[model samples]
Target: MTNLSAFLAQNAIKPDSQERVVSKRFVDPETKEPMKWQIVAVDSDRDEALRKQNTKRLPVPGKKNVFQPTTDYDAYLATLAVECTVFPNLHDVDLQNSYKVMGAEALLKKMLLPGEYAEYLKVVQNANGFDVGMDEAVEEAKN
Candidate 1:
């Protein structure tokens, strides 16, 4: 095949799907290492669903408890994440066990600390170019 033909054959992707990776890394407290995540891009339909899921109004006024129907903010973003990779000097097995233990919240706590869920939000958005709160009021405004 011609070089152009060969390159296209190797690099081309199916139009139906796109791939993206997190622009930043998360630090693992258990292993004291940094890890990165990757994921596939969701279409506009999926984005709309996420927007709806994250925009739930508070059931009662003056109550912001997370347990209630208050906005999830970025929970939808987390659902898009597919995998995470740790930085050098950390064994894969160790990280794997921690994945079994610390889970996403603990890992994010270690990675982002004072930023907490905000950092997790950043990781998910940066990975797939999602902005969680950008449309928090779109539905109500439309109605």
Candidate 2:
């Protein structure tokens, strides 16, 4: 029989938080240097919740009392980015007021430019382990 002890929660490796220089726009006032954003890998439960929140059910036009589920990908990513970010406090009221935005998602959208926003979303996805592919993992394992 295989040793299952290593798979136990206590024995398993925990996800570590990471700091990344996502953008050069935000800088320290005194240091005149870019600030790194803190991010962490969120558990699957949180991701599932976000997914469900973004998904909407629409009534099927031809069917009786039936609905088709659809997910808003852009909304999901925006929410995910806000959830994973740990530094500069996206939820801070002062930050939101400064950006003239009401919510965390809105603040993030307003802070970064169009291209920067797209790149930041990619960075957020990567932090959550979405950047790796099966082929890349296989290659790394082989090496």
**Among all candidates shown, the one with the greatest TM-score:** 2
- List candidate 1 segments past 4 Å from native: 1-36, 51-57, 60-70, 80-102, 111-120, 130-143
Instruction: Please list the residue runs of candidate 2 whose C-alpha ends up more than 4 Å from where it truly belongs after superposition.
Output: 132-143
Per-residue C-alpha lDDT of model 1 across residues 1-143, encoded as one tens digit per residue: 45676457568653333222322355557876654443345656877776576666545557565333444544544443322222221234465466554454344444444554455455545545545454653343334
lDDT leader: 2
- By summed lDDT, the worst window of 10 consecutive residues in model 2 runs over 134-143
> Local distance difference test, per candidate?
0.46, 0.85
The clash number for model 1 is 0
Worst 10 residues of 1 by lDDT: 82-91
Q: After TM-score superposition, what is the CA distance of residue 48 in candidate 2 from its true location, in Å? A: 0.4
Alpha carbon deviation, residue 70, candidate 1 (Å) = 4.5
Residue 89 error, candidate 1, Å: 18
